[model samples]
Target: MKKITIQEIAKLSGVSVSTVSRVINNSPSVSAAKRKKIQAIIDEHNYTPSVFARGMVNKQTKNIGVILPDISNPYFISLITQIQKFALDYMFSTILFNTMLAEPNNKNSKHPLTEEDYLKIILEKQVDGLLILGGEIDKEVVSKDYINALNQLNREIPVVVIGSKIPELNCLFIERNLKKGITTLVSHLTALDHKNIGFIGGEAGVKITSYRLESFKAAMASYNHSVNEDWIVLSDYYTADGYAAMTKLLENNTTLPTALVAINDNVAIGAIRAINDAKLSCPEDIAIVSCDQFMNGDYQTPRLTSMDQHNEYLGKMALLQLISAINGQVEPMIINHNPELIIRESCGSKL
Candidate 1:
């Protein structure tokens, strides 16, 4: 009762070991007829290639490790869905790691998993490539430890960051044009005569928050308007955070902003609820706009107006880039995707 090996499978199928390996890896290089014959032999022998053996032979496990900050967020969910889909199409398996414990405000965080921690785990697993979505990589000022860990990981396998940039690191980045997206959202609000516009959601010091905040200021200044510091509320990227921020704005400020720009749809939705609790009307008392356009936005009370970051497209592109880099077909590069503005009822746009 000895186990059948790939060598035996190849001999029985009348094909080379490399061809058998290609068939096992689901490579498209094998012809349909040959693939069928090889697969028939494999099935007859009930041959199952050992992952370790295959890795030793080809130096690849055909596994990609994906790390993201929050799985609850629809934006990240969409990205993961698309990434998994694309990986399946290429016959690669995905290992997902949710780094919720690594977020900024975890006071009781025992094992604060950083990019380095995940990289170590993924590397230990011997994944072909690594896809990082958020956490320390999204920070405006990345720590030395994180950067050093990332550098070490890059030397081993292809690393791709989605919607984040790590300076001085030779990692590939797939990001949306945050500045353009924020400016577009602000300009749209200004065009509708929104002068006193406030921002909600996203913590201070985060790269994404700074990018949108700075872009919002620049966009306001372009229209000869000034950003009132009192109206700006920085909070975590969550619905509850948005609600609390909006409530604080209403409670503390003498005069509320005519419109508000939320970091994402979750914040926008929560802000809308806050306004409702205060018996205030959206677009009448205050208009609202969001950066990330998710499916939930369409069914919201007012239907959120948002900048579509194209999460699915970004995910697909990141996987493609990672695969290419893994295959040595492309060098490390940055791909910036343009965000599209989806004008809906929340922004008070007639069109």
Candidate 2:
């Protein structure tokens, strides 16, 4: 069988090439009857528009590059899953690059790529847009090299960063309100008479950790409660880190805080493990609340009370913002998403 070009498809369907293109793009301008005819022919001959072929015409690969710190994380997994699902509606595909900046457990992994290297790869592939979920962009003090690479990338294509905004870098930013989430959780615990609440997990140097920790202090002060210097434990963002941090906290402080605010669900789960190891019961002995919700927070031993980041919604919005920027909507959009606190048994709010 001979290859059918877009022209041949248009001729076969009794339409112009542009009309066929419109149908292929799911454009509403095409008449319903013409769309049906073109679609049926598309299905019958299994005629699919090639991304490269379309790119030659419109200079768009219909592809987006997503750079995140770790793929093993449940939050990133769910986020990418949602982004991939929603990208279908826009007839777009995503290419993923994990920077592994969040303490990856993969001892046998691919050659690590710097943020610049990943940016270079994305540019070489000629992706139409870019979405950065986490990594150096979330650092307490971003490096000059990382900033320069991002500056170059922004000049080349539409870029969206789903973290704190760097004023110097001109890109669309979708900032998550980690501070508000912490404030809400702290208030929740305080309302339950948890005055001596300590914070666990997340490295102290990371910008995200600072955001949550600073908010914890502010929230405590707002309620006229003093923070115990001994109860504050800073560790990396992982289960093992959380476990070790909590164990150390348990050991160093004979008198522990009545409750704890975890960096995230994964860390919260780790702290709970440590609690059990110490032969102490969660909620009964120490109430726990997670700053960010994960996939399995509900199934944990006592179930986790967490701040829902709405990853699905965030994923969708990130793609939409990128698309808008790709379409020349270059007015630097900043979206602030406040996390919602989902009450569960972990915090023992009911009790």
Candidate 3:
């Protein structure tokens, strides 16, 4: 019933504590015979190395801190799963912090955990690196105080940003190419002779919404089509918001656009519900496409045509880049991921 320690394994294996440490750390310096003997004793005793003990010798806690906005969203959930998977493979543990206290329409609202709060915790925990996703980084303008806090944190520990960019702070960024993905979505609609394309969902001041809306405009312009400002509705990134935005658009506009582009699958699904509730058929009356793809999109009345951002790959790459930065092998830089357009029934391609 007692927990066996590495020291006990070393003594039982007839090896020094240093040899046991080397074996536990997977160092090649330990001879094969000694490794076999030590490993057998370790397995027999069910010994596990204390992260604290290893940190004392190597000056590394072998732990990573991850901060993201909301884990309930499928996009963030998938991304975090991949990140945690990669970190575990490399013998690193991840600590997650969900800062979900974002206020509606206000970018500068103080959340439950301030930047200083995160900094203090990270320092106290002595994590080797930090992975930041969403929150203030998703804002069009990051506060100077938050930037200063991140700068100080980066000085003490390596930091990487996933799916957002903070230019003022010296941090590595891994993001999908917003313009190209939106362009692809528009091109698909234009190819189907959809001239009047509308956009739905996304708050006004958020950085991602701004980037995506700009990309939508550029993509539309490329086809010599001017965007209808009336069709462009601004709302939060949720299904109910999308439904309300669509309903408002229907109420205000005498002529509806032939096609609508939702910011993401959640928005697209809600828009589809609103269209059906209005006694209009999807794809037949208004073709719909989404910027992001997830599992639920497939089972809808009409399958959603969406741009796949390869979130899992993004998560894995972010962790790998962070490890490289922690090892002093790479400089802080921006990494862009290209999204793929998936054609399906929602856009009327199959119909």
The C-alpha RMSD in Å for every predicted model, in order, reads 3.4, 3.0, 3.2
Identify the candidate with maximal lDDT.
Answer: 2
**In candidate 1, where is summed lDDT lowest over 10 consecutive residues?**
102-111
lDDT of 3 by residue, 1-351 (tens): 899987788789888999999998799999899999999988888888887788778778889999988888878888899899999898899999776754442366664556557667877888999998788777887788878888889888998887666668887887768888899999999999999999999988888899999999999999999899999999988889889989999999999999999999899989989999999989999999999887677888899999998887788889999988887866755565878898889899954
**Pairs in steric clash, model 1:** none
Backbone clashes for every candidate come to 0, 0, 0
lDDT of each: 0.87, 0.88, 0.86
Best-to-worst ranking by TM-score: 2, 3, 1
Which has the better lDDT: candidate 1, or candidate 3?
Answer: 1
Model 3 residue runs over 4 Å out of place are: 1-23, 26-48, 102-115, 333-336
Quality of model 2 by C-alpha lDDT: 0.88
User: Model 1: per-residue lDDT, tens digit, 73-191?
Assistant: 88889989999999989768999988876635454878666556777888898889999888788888888888888889989999888866556887888866889988898888889
Query: lDDT per residue, candidate 2, 52-80, as tens digits?
Result: 78877888889999998889888899999
TM-score-better candidate, 1 vs 3: 3
Residue 241's lDDT in candidate 3:
85
Better of 2 and 3 by TM-score: 2
- The best candidate by TM-score is 2
Could you estimate the TM-score for every candidate? 0.86, 0.90, 0.86
